[model samples]
Each structure stands twice: as structure tokens, then as C-alpha cells.
Target: MKPQSMLFTIYGEYVRHYGSEIWIGSLTKLMGEFGLSEPAVRAAISRMLRQGWLESRKVGNRSYYSVSERGKKRLEEAAARIYKVETDVWDGKWCIASYNIPEERRALRDQLRKELGWMGFGMLTTSTWISPNNLSDRVKELTEAHEITEYVEIFTSEHMGWSNPKQLVQKCWDIDEINEKYKSFIDAYREEYEQLSAKMSNGEAVPDSHCFVEKTKLVHQYRKFLFIDPDLPQELLPELWLGKEADELFQNYYQLLNPGAVRFFETVYEAAPSA
Candidate 1:
């Protein structure tokens, strides 16, 4: 993995397990497991802390860091943007060409499929190939993202096509279903937010641990969209699918976790989806 992707994975794991409250020893252990050096680990942690993705507390002689409420919200937003549903019409001209992957790398092939699905590849058949409606830039993205630029082949043909538009629509409806699932979450969150606001207005004591509640709420709010379709392979996500706007959203979410940065990210998240 590249440095940026590695950092994202590391931070993602930390947030998932420790929710930002991490110690040096734990970080060191993570580094060892990931085969990262102490300096690299420390640098990544410091960078995230500086970027407001983490908050540090000094008690006695030890320091611990945890994801702030803002951080948690940002993470939720990032997850949504990364896995949000996209409505694209398939153009039916292009198709994916996969080769005989080694038995040892079968897991890798599965990973590729999941990635591809995230990137918009529909599995037409098992190992033979996968494709999206319009293959233009998505193809290039898959190549680089999977590091199979030279290994995989792309062809324009109609050898095996989906004859049932209804079935195809249903298959592609995962995004819509996922969006609906999250809508309920968002609605519940709205209700909770209203209650929380009313309590605050009544001069009720809002405990510091409420931050955890906020984090949990955000996770629940977006958890429905976290994973790709289980049936899909993981490694086939097109890198280009995460365009500049997505990158901007990710960065904005990271920054928005700081106090006073919420509005900025909210606007970005609510902005029109990419083309």
C-alpha cells in the first residue's frame, strides 16, 4: 500500500478499536504488526493530531489521544463519501477481462472484486470478468488502484450481456437500498439531536462523555454504508472513482472535526455528488 493508503488504514483501525484514545505502547504494537517503523508511526499520529483528527490528554507522565467528537463525525462523513451510492446508467459496450490468478492469490482476487464493486464493477461472471455500464475512466482507475494495470485486459464486446433490465436494475439497486438504510439512521439521529438540544437549552449538564454518544451516533448514522456488497470482490475498486471532489471531501471531513469546522464539511458533504 502507498503511504497515504497505509496511513488511512492505520488511522481507521485506531479509530475503530480505540476510538482515538490510544497510547504509545498500543501504537507501537500496531506499527510492529503493520511493519511500520516507530518514527513513521509517530509521525503519522502527530500529523493526525495536528490535523484535529485526534485529541491528546496528558495525565501524570503519560499522554493518550482519542478521536474528538469532531473527529468521529468527520470519520462518519468520510465513510459515507467513500461508500456512498452512485446512480449511473450502464453503457453496455465495455467489459472486464481477468486472467488466471494463482491459487495462492485467490484471496487477493476476492479483494479485487470487492474493490471493483466499490468502484462500480458489476460481476457478470465469477472469475472471468466484471464491468460497469460505461467503462471510460473507471477502467484506468481499476488498473492503477489494483496495481494490475498490465495484468488485466479490457475489451469492447457484447459476448455476455445482461438481457434482463429488471434484474440488472435490481442488482444495481444495492446503492439505493443502502441509502434507504442510512436514511432511517439519519432520521433517528435527528430525533436525538433535537432531544439533546432541548436538554442543553434547559441548562441541563451535558457531560464530557456526551462526546462518546455523539461519536456513536455518527457511526450508527453511517454504518449502513460502510461495507461493499459482501458478494462482490474487494480489490476491484476503481481508483479514479474517488475523484478530486472525493479527496476534497475526505480532507474537508478531516479538518471539519475540529470545533468550528463542522459547517464547512457539512456543505461539502451535501454538495452535489460527482458526475
Candidate 2:
């Protein structure tokens, strides 16, 4: 990961759990896990501050930063989607969105398409996208935001084609590619879970820095699936879905790593100084 991305990755995992406000010095020390120098880290903070993602304050001679309200809201909304375990149900319906944008507005059309894809809409054609999820309100908001309300329409309907639904899902989404990422997450963290399990069994201590780094990397890597994978319901998935197995591993391994990870973080960012 790039140094700046690494900083926000750490903040999302550590700073959110440890506290809202982070001391600049402590943040620098915590970022040592990523081997980022102070200058690069400082540049990241500066960029975040200018982008209205962070607010800065001074405490005695030290600087502290907190996520801006805008940033906090963004994180909370994203977390809701990223860590969600499963859809309530498939509902046996697909939301179809059809749009007609002027050629002069190709950029806006492309942006709308990108956002639709992110919102779980899969392309059925250049001008149409579909999803098993109910997303009428979301599509309305997008069109309204672009002042193109007249250009788009959505319908909720079931796929009636005899083409095996499983095959259709494959054509719409690169499930195999997404499955590989989940597998990658499993391969990387399964060993960490085993080692941590052994340590806990023997009452061995895990270093704060090691715990912090490992947890951050694990979360960062797993979080990428939010953008690429739609978290489709089980009925739509292939049998023996690796995503399901990978999610089980994620939940299990994350629990194993939490104790030492929290212990280490408390020292770097949350601990009170000794009297």
C-alpha cells in the first residue's frame, strides 16, 4: 500500500477503536508499523486536513488530529456496508435501471455508471444495469444529484429467462476473481490466527507494534472486497463458494488477533502516561 493509504488504513482500524483524537507523536510511532517516515506521514495528515477529512488542534506543545464530522459520517456509512455479514434475503427480484444520457454528457454518464456498479448494479448492457438488491431510492438520489432525473428509470422485476441463473450471475460478475481475493485474505491471516492462538494458550505476550501492524494489514486487505464484490446472496452464488469460507476465516481470525492488537494499540495511542 502507498504510505498515505497506509496512514488512513491504520486510522480506520486503530484510531477509530482507540479514540477519535490522535496525538501526532503517537500516530508517528504507530505508523512505524508501515515503515513510513515522519515526513510522508505528515504529508498525509496535511492532505487529509486540507480535504476536510481531519481537524487539527494543539495540546500543550503536541498536535492532535480528529476525524472531521464529514469524515466520521463517511466512515460509519462505509463500515455499515463493508462489515455487513449478509443480505437479509434475495427477494427473488432484480432492480433494472435504464438510462439515456446525451453524448455531450458522457463524463456524467460514466460517473453514474461507476457509482451504480459500486452500489451493486451489474451491467446487463451499456445502458442498463441490474441487481438483486432493492436500490430504487439509491438510484433516485444519484440521478437527482446529477440533475438528470428525466434521463433514468428503474424497475423491480424477476429474471424470466431459462438461461441458468447461475450462468447469468457469472456473466454479470467476475465471481471467480472476487473469490481469489477472499482466498488471498484467508491464506495471509490463517497462519497469524494459528500463531496467535498458540500464544494465548501458553500465556505469551504479543508485541503491540506487531499486533497493530498485522491487524491493520488484515483489515485493509479484506476491506478491498467491499468495492469489488457485491456480497451477493447465497442462492446466487456457486456451490462450495470460497467467499463463504473466507468470511468464516475472517471472523475467526479477527477474534484471535483482537486481544494482543488492542493491548498494543492502547500503549501507543490510548494508554495514560505513568505517574
Candidate 3:
């Protein structure tokens, strides 16, 4: 994994739970488990700082970093979805965003598109994005943050088209493609989960450091779904959707590895001098 992406996973899974702050040296040391070089970690930290995802502080000779408020909001949003087992009831409404940004402001336009996708909106056209989820608050936040309120319009309404909801869903996202990705995850991890469960049940000893690496890798791999899966409501999803199954396996595996992982992480984290 790239240092920046791994850092996000680390923050979301670990540091975000334990004070949301860490010494720079502790971060580098933890990152070493994934074979990320200290220089790469530093560079990634600098990039995140410039992007406003991280804020830095200094105490005497040591530097410390923490997720910014903006970053914390994003991380909290992601965590809610990441750990979500039950799909929320759909009100049969779509949240639509339409923008007429001028070509001269192409950079702003591109950023808006990215933000829309991150907020689970799928592109129906170059300037029109839609989602089945209620995202009015997030849309308002995006518009206000980017100063694009005048260029964008938000609507929440039922689609009155000839096509059915499933058809509309198919058009917006490749359900089959997303399902195949979930299948891949299940195929890769099912055996690992069974093996680990067997080990634990048999009283076999697994190293805390090893469990930390496994759990981190598991979370890193599973978190990629946040980018690809828009997480449509159950009524819109196909009957054989593997997302719930994948989530079950992920949760079980995570719980199996969590205790040891926490111990290992705390050992490294608490040893660092407070800054």
C-alpha cells in the first residue's frame, strides 16, 4: 500500500481511537511494519499537511501530528459506513446534484466531481450526479467549502422515469462489477479467517506483532471498498449481493485479530515519549 493510504488506514483504525495524536517517530516506527520507509512516511505526512488532512505540532525537538477537524469528519463518516451491517431503509428518493460550472473553472469542476464521487454520487452525465442516499447535508457542506454554491443545484426527488429503480441503479453503478470485487475478497479471506479461528480455538499462540500486521492488512484491504462501493440501499441491490457476507467475514476476522493487534500497537504507541 502507498504510505499515504496506509496512513489513512492506520489513523482510522488505530490512532483515531487512541487520542488521535501521535509522535512523528511513533508513526514512522509503526509504518515500518508495512515496509514503508521513514522518508516515505515523512513525505506522505508533508503531503497530507499541505492537503489539510493532517496538522503538525512541535514540543521541544520532537514533532507530533494529528488528524485535522476536516479529516476527522471524513474519517467518522467513513467509519460509520465501514462498520455498518444493516442497510438503512430507502425512502425511494434520489439526491441529485447538477452543476453548470464554467469551463474556465475546470479545476473546481474536477474537484467537485471527485467530492461527489466520494460522497457516493454516481455520474449520470458530465455535470449531473445522483445517489439513492440522502446526502443533502454533505452536498451543502461541499458547496459551502468550495464556494460553488452558485454553480450547483441540489434536488431530492423520486425518479419518475419509465425505467425501474434497479435499471437506474445499473446505469449509475456496475453492480456486477462491485459484486465480483466482493467475491474476490471473500475468496481470499474466508480461508484465512477459518485458519485463524482454528488456531485460536486450539490454543495456539500467535504473536501480537503478527496479529497487528494481519489486522492492519485486513482493514487496509477492506477499506478499499469505500472507494468502489457506493453502498446502495437493500431494496436497490441485487438479491445475491455479497457485500453483507464480505462484511461478516471482515468483522469476524477483525475481532479475532483485534486483541493482539491492540496490545502490539499500544506497546509501540505508549513507549513513545509524550510531546
Candidate 4:
């Protein structure tokens, strides 16, 4: 994993729960477990700091880092979706965004496209995007952040076209491809889950370090779905969707690893003079 992405997973899964701060030394030591060098960790931290995703303080000549408010809000939103078991009923209303950024600001326009996709908006046309989720605040935030509010229009409306809702979904997203990705995830983790479950049942003593690594990798892998999965409501999903099954497996596997992982993390976190 890239050091920056790994750091995000670490902060979201571990540091946020324990005072939401860590000494640079503790952070580096923990990251070392994932084969990240101190320099790489430091560089990643610098980028996140510049991006307003992290804040730093000094205590006794040592630097400390914590997620910024923006980072915390982002992590919380991510966690809610990552661990969500039930999809909320769709309101049947669509949140749509349309933009006509000037060609001179092509870079900004491209960035807006990426951000919209990350926010789970699928392209309905060259300049228009749509999602079933209510995203008035998020839409406002992104457009204002990009200083393109005047160039964009936001709307909420029900489908009134000839195509059915599922057809609209098809035109906007590759549901088949998404389902295949979910299948791959289940295939990769199912056996591991079964083995771990058996080990715990047999009173086998698993190593804390192992748990830490497994949980971190599990979360890192699962979190990727946030970008790829628009998290559509059940009404828009296929009858045999694998997303729910994958979520169930993730939750079970995570719970099984939680105690050991937390213990390992705390052991490392408290190892510094003051973390």
C-alpha cells in the first residue's frame, strides 16, 4: 500500500479511538510493521498535513500528529459506510450535478469529475452526474471548494423518463463489474475467516502482531470499496447482490481480530516516552 493510504487506514482504525493523536515516534514505529520506512511515513504525513487532513503539535521537542477536523469527519463518514449492514430505503429522488467549467480551467474541471465520482456520483452525461443519496451539503462543499459554484447547478428530481430506474442505473454505472469485484473479495477472505474462526474455537493462541496485521490489511482492502461502490439503496440493487454478504464477512472477521489488534496497537502506542 502507498504510505499515505496506509496512514489513513491506521489513523481511522486505531489512532482515532485513542485520543485521536500520536507522537511521531509511535506513528513511525507502528507503520514500520507494514514495511514503511520512517522517511516514507514522514513524507506521507507532510502531504496529508498540506491537504488539511492532519494537524501537528510539538510536545517536549517531539512532534505529535492528529487528524484534522476535516479528516475526522471524513473518517467517520467512511466508517459508517464501511460497517453499514443495511441499506437505507431509497427516496426515489436523485441528486444531480451539472457543470460547465471553462476549458481554460481544464485541470479544475477534471478534478471536479474525480471528486464527484469519489462522492458516489455517476456520470449521466458528459457534464451531468447523479446519485440516489442526498448530498446537498457535500455538493455545496465540493463546488465551493473548487470555486466553481457559478459554473455548476445542483438539482433533486424523480425519474420522469421512458427508461426504468434500473436502466438509468445501468447507463450510469457498471453494476456487473462491481458485483464481480465483490465476488473476488468474498473469495479472497472467506477461507481466511473460516480458518481464523476455527483457530479461536480450538483455543489456539494467535499472536497479537498477526491480528494487528490482518485487521489493518482487512480494513485497507475493504475501504477501497468506498471509492468503487456508490452504495446504492436496496431498491436499486440486484436481488443476489454480494455486497451484503461481503459486509457481513468483514464485520465478523473484524470483530474476531479486534481485541488482539487493539492490544498490539496499544502496546506499540504506549512504547514511546509519551504518545
Candidate 5:
């Protein structure tokens, strides 16, 4: 994960409990467990400030950093996807969008496509995108945000011909590739989950260092699904979706880690030397 992305996980996941502010001292010490150097963390913070994703305040020569309002909104949206589990009953409808952008504004075109993908849209053609989810509001938000109102057309449609929507699923996305990732993620964390679960069940306390490291790794792994999974409805997904199984394991393990993670985080902040 990028240093900045990991910072987001830190701030979004735990720092919010402390009024969304982290002293540079506290942040650097915390990030060390994730193998981030102080200089790297500072550099990432500088970049985030310039990008309007972070804000800072100074108190007697000491600095505290927090997510900017814009970044806070982004983190909240990301959290919705990262933590939510739903058996969305597919309405058998699709939100389709077609757009044309000037070649000169290739950057904007790329931004549009990327945002759509993040919103779980997939390509039907170079110009058209589709999602089983009702993304009309999200697409409109994108158009307005990008100021590309005139370049886009959106419609919601249902299957009407002999061809099945299921047939198009594979072309729009690599379900096989997604499933493999689910398998790998599950395998990677299986033993960790078992041990954590056992510890929690036995009411055994976890070490602060271990808790910090495990929590970071768990959030990092779970956050990846926000980018990789389109979160298609059950009807459109393969039977016995490993993604569902993975979610169960993720949630089950995370619940066990949460208390210890919070304890470790709180203690770390409390240990920071006051300016």
C-alpha cells in the first residue's frame, strides 16, 4: 500500500476517535510499525497537504495533522464499502452511461473512467459503462464534480432480448480473477484469524505491539477489496461466492482485533511526549 493510503487507514480507522488529529510525533511512531520511516511519513504528509487531503495545526512548535474535510468525506465513503455487507436483491436493472470527452482533455477522460470503476461501473464499450447497482446519483455527482455535464448520457434499462445479462458479466469484469484474490486473501489470513478468534474467545489479552501490527495488516487487506470488488448483486455473482465467505472471515476476525487495536492505539497516543 502507498504510505499515504496507509495514513488514511490510520486516520480514518482510529485517529477519528481522538478528534481526527494526530501529532506528528504520534503519527511517526505509529507508522513505524508499518515499516514507514519518519521522513517518508513527513513527505507523504506534505504531499497530502498540497493535494487538499490533509490539514495541519501548530501548537508551540509542535504540529498536529488531520484529514481535510474533502478527505474526510472520501474516507467515510470508502468506509461504507469496506465495512458494509449486504445481500442486495438485484432488481434486474442496470445503470448505463455513455460519455464523450475531447481528446485534448484526456486527463479528465481518464478521471471519469477511473471514478466510474471505483463506483462499481464496468465498461460495456469504450464509451459506455454499466453497473447493477443504482449509481445514477453517483454518476451525476461525478459529472457535476468534473464539470462535464454536456459530455455524458445516462439511462437505466432492463434485459429485454434473448441474450442474458449474466453473459455480459464476464466480459465487463474478471470474476475468475476476483475469486482468486478472495481465495488468496482468505488463505493468507486464515491462521491469523483462527489464533485471534481463539484468543478473543479465551478472553486473553493481546500485546500492544502485536495488536498494532495485526490491526494495520487486517485493515490494509480489507481496504483492498474496496478497489478490487465491484460488489455485484448475488444473482449476478457465482454461486458460493468466495467473496461472501471472505467477508465472514474478515468481520469475524476484525471484531476480535478491534478492542485490542483500540487499546494499543490509545496507549500509543498517550505515550507521545507533550510539546
Candidate 6:
């Protein structure tokens, strides 16, 4: 992970759990949890403080720190960027499911696999189903959209023993119980996407800094709906989806504006061509 990203994640955890009052030791502990070295942790903290994301008080030999309002806002935004929700429950019909994803949605398929893993989908064999969830409506939509229906199949009950009990214990992917936890997040994302689309159509500039901050918050909150992949090399498939969604939404909005602006902004933002 990028140092800045790691720093924000650590800072967010501290603020969320301990409020604004945090000690260096607690921060250090979080760093260890994330497998970061002490020096890297300190550097991230220093950078965050310098950026006005954290405020520190010096007393004796120790410096106590807490997230400033600016820091809090940034952390919230980062959380939105980093977190997402799963919309389905695994019925445990399979141990690992495989899908022959379309080229157009390769990224999306990769993202779904990562998310399914995060939600407890295991891989007994590549592209084979192994989640404990019964297929849900949302999952169906996602799979269909990615055109992987034929490639997917439920595993028989006999496949259960294939899972490594130790690994399963360590990484739980049961996400059915948390469906309600994602309602607000899904609503917020849809609302933001719609509003941003409108604003772009009206030729309004992408809101002010404060509004941008709020948008970022919504983006972070929006992530709670997607599944994450634990087995994937990078655990950011959800983040990648958000970026792609944002780019698509922006392009749609831009096209509604003056024609010339579309190419201009696309070049500046370096957006992928719309699918």
C-alpha cells in the first residue's frame, strides 16, 4: 500500500475507535498490525501532521496526537475510497467457483472475484464456486452483467472438506448477515452519482473543495456494497471499481456539456474510453 494511504487508514482507525485523543504507542500498534515498519509509520504520521491531517501536543518526552477536523474529513474520505459492502449471501453451495469473464469486463470480473473472496468465497479450483452464500439478487445481477453465467456453477456438499479449516477460520467471508449495513452506502452512492451527473450536465464545475470532500466521503461509503478478494494479489478491486465508476459517470456528465469539453477533460483526467 502507498504510505499516504496506509497513514490515512491508521489515522482513521485511531479516530474511529479512540476519538481524537491518541498516543504514539497506539499508532505504532496499528502500524504493526498493517505490517509496516516503525520508521515508515513515523514518516507517514509526520507527513499527515504536516498536511494538517493531525494535530500533536508535546508534553515531556512524548507527543500526543489526534485527528484535526481536516484530518477527520480526510480520513472519512479515505475510508469511503477504501471500503465497500457486499450485497449477497453465500449459500455454501460451492467451495470455489470459476467464471469465464468477458474481455470487456475483465476488470469487473477480477474485482468480483476479489470481493467474493472477501465475502468468504474460497477457491478449491480456479473458476469454481465455493462460497457459503446462496446466490442473491445482487450477485446474480453482477454475474450476469459480467457475462459469466455459463462459467459459474455451484459445488456439491462433498466439496466442503476441501477447504483448509485453519485458513477458513482465519479469513471468514460470510457477508449475508451484513446486508442491512450497506443500505445507506448504496443509497448514498446512487445519489452522488446522479447529482454529479446533473451538475456536469448543467455545465457546473465539479463542486468546491468542501463539496469535493463530501463527494469523496460518499465514494468511500459507496464501497461497502462490493465484495473484496483476500486471495488476490492486490486487495483494491473495490477501489478500482469506484474509480472506474467515477470515470464513467464523469464522462457521461461531460458529454452532456459543451462538446469540446469532453475530449479536453478526458485528456486531462486520462479517463479510459467508455465501455
The TM-scores of all predictions, comma-separated, are 0.43, 0.82, 0.97, 0.95, 0.92, 0.31
Q: How far off is residue 129 in model 3, in Å?
A: 0.9
lDDT score at residue 21, model 6, on the 0-100 scale: 55
Q: Any residue pairs clashing in model 3, and if so which?
A: none
lDDT (tens digit, per residue) of candidate 4 on 1-275: 99999999999999999878888988999899989999999999999999999999887798889999999988998998887767778889999999999999999999999888888989999999999999878999989988999999999999999889988998998899989999999999999999999999999999999999999999999999888899899889888789888889999999999999999999889422454
Q: What local distance difference test score does each model get? A: 0.49, 0.79, 0.92, 0.91, 0.85, 0.49
lDDT of 1 at 240: 27
Model 5 ranges off by over 4 Å? 199-205, 270-275
lDDT of 2 at 138: 80
Among all windows of 10 consecutive residues in model 4, the one with the lowest summed lDDT is 266-275
Worst 10 residues of 5 by lDDT: 266-275
Error of 6 at 39 (Å): 1.3
Query: How many residue-pair clashes does candidate 2 contain?
Result: 0
Looking at candidate 3, the ten consecutive residues that score lowest on lDDT are 266-275
For model 3, what is the error of residue 189's alpha carbon versus the real structure, in angstroms, after optimal superposition? 0.8
Q: Which stretches in model 3 have alpha-carbon errors above 4 Å?
A: 271-275
Question: What TM-score does model 4 achieve against the real structure?
Answer: 0.95
In terms of TM-score, how similar is model 1 to the real structure?
Answer: 0.43
The residue-by-residue lDDT of candidate 2 on 1-275, one tens digit each, is 77666766766776766556788888888777778889988999999999788888875687888888866765675577767776676788888899999999999999999888878878888899988888888888779978998889989988899766678788788888888878877787778788887987899977766766777777777777767887677789887678777777777777777777878878778432221
Q: Judged by lDDT relative to the true structure, which candidate is superior, 1 or 5? A: 5
Question: 107-144, model 3: which lDDT tens digit per residue?
Answer: 99999988888888888888899999999889999899
Q: Clash number for every model? A: 19, 0, 0, 0, 0, 36
